[model samples]
Target: MVFKRRHKEKLIEATLFWIGSLTIIILILICLFLFRDALTLFSTHSFYSFVTGSLWYPTADPPLYGLIPLLLGSVLVTFGAICISVPLGITSAIYISEIASPRVASFLKPFIEILAGIPSVVYGFFGLVVLAPYLQLWLDLSTGQVALTGSVMLAVMALPTIISISEDAISSIPSSIREGSLAMGATNWQTIYKVVLPAALSGISAAVMLGMGRAIGETMTVMMVTGNAAVIPGMPEGIVESVRTMTATIALEMGEVPIGSEHYHALFAVGSVLFIMTFLINLAADIIKKKYRFKLEGS
Candidate 1:
């Protein structure tokens, strides 16, 4: 009986170990596959011009690969989305975590989760049909599809992630801290603002970082609404004009490229840029979180 039990335990341990190893190996293989063309971008002289210059005529005979225009479009739209999402998302989360009744929170939480589950393409279509037209009417722009419209759509999409993370952070705050603040004659709002928020600052920062990641990576909605022009105009002028993003550039052109063409590798180069950007954002978030945690511990 002892031998049988020992055998079973060994078998399970071995199986779990192999499963974890295989998963890591598979992930590495996938990363390599996706990043293979990143190397070619470095080898080409056009790489600098592609990344730094504004011209992006990929289909031109010599295929100008300047990525600045696309990069700018992405930044503008993401910045707008972050502006819309961050405050609203954080406030909503605070309300749910610190203020709302249990019954109300229980009901609302699922609704927010449902919003996250909605498909990106659905969001894109919604932007195309509804938000775009509304923006055009309000701004009196010639075209409804623009960077602002894409930003609005991305904002809506990022809300779920932001709200969910912020809520969790606020909820994780110790009830004792709230009680102590109240004992000090602080109002509920004061307790939340002066005590709770500072304590959960790391988590809130993480939530914002996560939302920014989502805004940056969102493709379909931006593709549908951004008008897909590749011009490097100033922010004020570009806001009114059409624009393209890195994700949209790759999505739009990848299919038409011959399999082994420079264009194909260029798409991978864009992917590498995106990957690096996300990685750096996540790293920054981590550093912020650790610093905040240390501050809390010291206090």
Candidate 2:
């Protein structure tokens, strides 16, 4: 019996190892594919001009392909979405996981699940039809289809991911930790804020990273609502101004461009930039998580 159990364990371990290895292989293939097409974009255009120039006209005579404004747009919208989602998502998770009754949490979860399951196109439509008009009237912008509009819509889309994961992280903290804090005369809020949150910081960081990744890669909703104008606005308040993101740019223009044309290659290059940005963002989050976890454990 002992031998049979050991054999079964080895088989399960081998199966899991191969599945993980296959995923690594798939990721390597995807990187190769992206860089392969991306290199062609720089064959004719100077890499400096492609990155530094402010214009993004792909159809004009001697068409220019600057990435600064698109990057800015992506940054602004993502920053705004993070600002909106993090507070609300983390707060809701705290309420659901720690404060709320099981019935209340159950009632809330289906709505979140429904929201998450809705297609991006439907969110796009909602942004276009419902949110756009309200922003236009309330903020008095020239048009409602701007970075702010896209940011809000993306925040809504990211909320389910953030909240669900964070709640799980908080709920998974051992009951002994809570009991210890309570025995030390900590108030409920103090225990939650001081002990539980620190214990779950790594998971919260992961949740935030995933939510940010989702916001940054969103295409349909951003394209439909962000006005798709590839120019940096003049003022800081221009976060409310029309802008375009890299993902939206690729989605909007990739279909009609001729195969192997400069435009086509350029779009692939944009995708590569997006891939790098996501990698860097997650890397930074991971570093922070490690530092925070070390501090908590040491204390």
| Residue range 160-185, candidate 1, lDDT tens digits | 99999999999999899999999999
- Superposed by TM-score, candidate 2 places the C-alpha of residue 289 at a distance from the truth, in angstroms, of 2.5
Highest lDDT model number: 2
The candidate scoring highest on TM-score is 2
Model 1: ten consecutive residues of lowest lDDT: 39-48
Q: Each candidate's lDDT (Cα)?
A: 0.89, 0.93
Residue 151 miss distance in model 2 (angstroms): 0.6
For residue 280, model 1's alpha carbon misses the true position, in angstroms, by 0.7
Clashes of 1: 2
Q: Across residues 8-66, which tens digit of lDDT does each residue of candidate 2 receive?
A: 99999999999999999999999999999989989898999988989999998999899
My TM-score estimates for the predictions, one after another, are 0.93, 0.95
Which pairs of residues clash in candidate 2, taking residues 3 or more apart in a chain or in different chains? none
